[model samples]
Target: MTRAAVALIYRRTDNSGTQLLFIQRARREGDPWSGDMAFPGGRMQPEDASPRATAERETLEETGLDLGRHGRFRARLSDLITRHHSRWRPMVVTPYLYEWKGPKAVTLNHEVEHLVWVPLDFLAAEENQGRRPWRTPLGTLNMPCCRYQDYCIWGLSYSMVQELLAQGLP
Candidate 1:
């Protein structure tokens, strides 16, 4: 089994106190989640000591923002779900939440085409409501959706967002 990690990076904006960083995946041929909005992260490398290290490393690799330069770790969730990517087998995805206090300039890699800073208010609004089809070992399932910008941040990302929101925004 493989393991992965993702950082749900966020900061406070002048207009809105809290804003999330979402990436628009670069359109790649044969990529499963191409062009979808997602958090900054990837599969864990051999050099990674732990899942947290993998999260921090992948965040910097994908977004060019170091998590250590930001505030201390707010929360860490483990063994959320394994959203199988066709190229890769089922991966244990660990989600990390970090509070950032600085400029939001993202240096995207080839895997990312564009980025969006979505406000929490907008995400909690009714406009972002929808439904998503999910496939699991049990069977096919349709879950509620949370749309952000041009993409619907459903699936595991949506579950992580809900967890963060339930814990109260930082």
Candidate 2:
């Protein structure tokens, strides 16, 4: 099985609320997750010492956010498995949570088309949670997700949020 890692970066607001950072992947042909909302991450490279290291490196490479310089490791959410399908292979993904203490401005690389800081409160609200039908390589299916503005957080990203919420906010 393949393994990957992602950084779930968040920050505390002046009003005591928290916001989590997400990236909109740039569209590309043959990319299964193209144009989808996701965290800063990618498949583990040989140089990575651990999953945490992969998350840190990917965050910096994709967003120009130096987690090592401004992030505090908070928790490791549950590892999630991607569904096996004809167009995609199953993989395991480890998620590392980080509290960001740096500037709000981010320098995105080519992999990321846009970024959004979504409030924790907004995600936890029941009204904002629902299942949306998505057409995949298999067929159209109703998938659980959280909608924020024009982006929809689903699949592994959504599972990570659920795990984080279940573990209680830090």
Candidate 3:
């Protein structure tokens, strides 16, 4: 089965609050998740020793944030499997949580359009939880999502976020 990994990079704010980083993938032809908001990650490569390695490597390549050198490993959320009707074949997604201790500078690569640091409280608040329409091969359906500013976090990424929230912050 296909597998992938994502890094849920977070940091503590000045007021002792937490913020999670999210990235908007660059729009590109033939890309299923183009322009979608998601955590920094990608499909696992053969050279990756573990899912954690895939997450760290992808995060660094997409956002230029060296999680391997500057991040502290935290909780590991439950694996999420893509639905059959997803753009691609069903795949196992491993979400790795990390507390970023790196610099403020972020140099995004072509894979990423832009990145945002969303407050954990904002994500946890019930008021921010809502649904958004998603177009699937079957039909357009309203999917549970989190509305953050102009971005809507949904699908597998949303599932991972819910899993993280269910387990509470580390």
lDDT of 2 by residue, 1-170 (tens): 77889999999999999999999999988877788899999888889999899999999999999999999999888888874333377888899999999987789999999999999988889999989788866999999999999999998899889888878865
TM-score for each of the candidates:
0.87, 0.93, 0.93
Write down the TM-score for model 1. Answer: 0.87
Return the clash pairs for model 1, or none: none
The residue ranges of model 3 lying beyond 4 angstroms of the native Cα positions read 83-88
Q: Tens digits of per-residue lDDT for model 1 on 47-134?
A: 9998889988888888788897864578896567575677456678999888886556768788888878788877778877788887
Ranking of predictions according to TM-score:
3, 2, 1
Give candidate 2's error at residue 54 in angstroms: 0.4
Give the local distance difference test score of model 3. Answer: 0.89
Best by lDDT: 2
Query: Where does candidate 2 stray beyond 4 Å?
Result: 83-89
Give the backbone clash total of model 1.
0
Clashes of each: 0, 0, 0
By TM-score, the better pick of 1 and 3 is 3
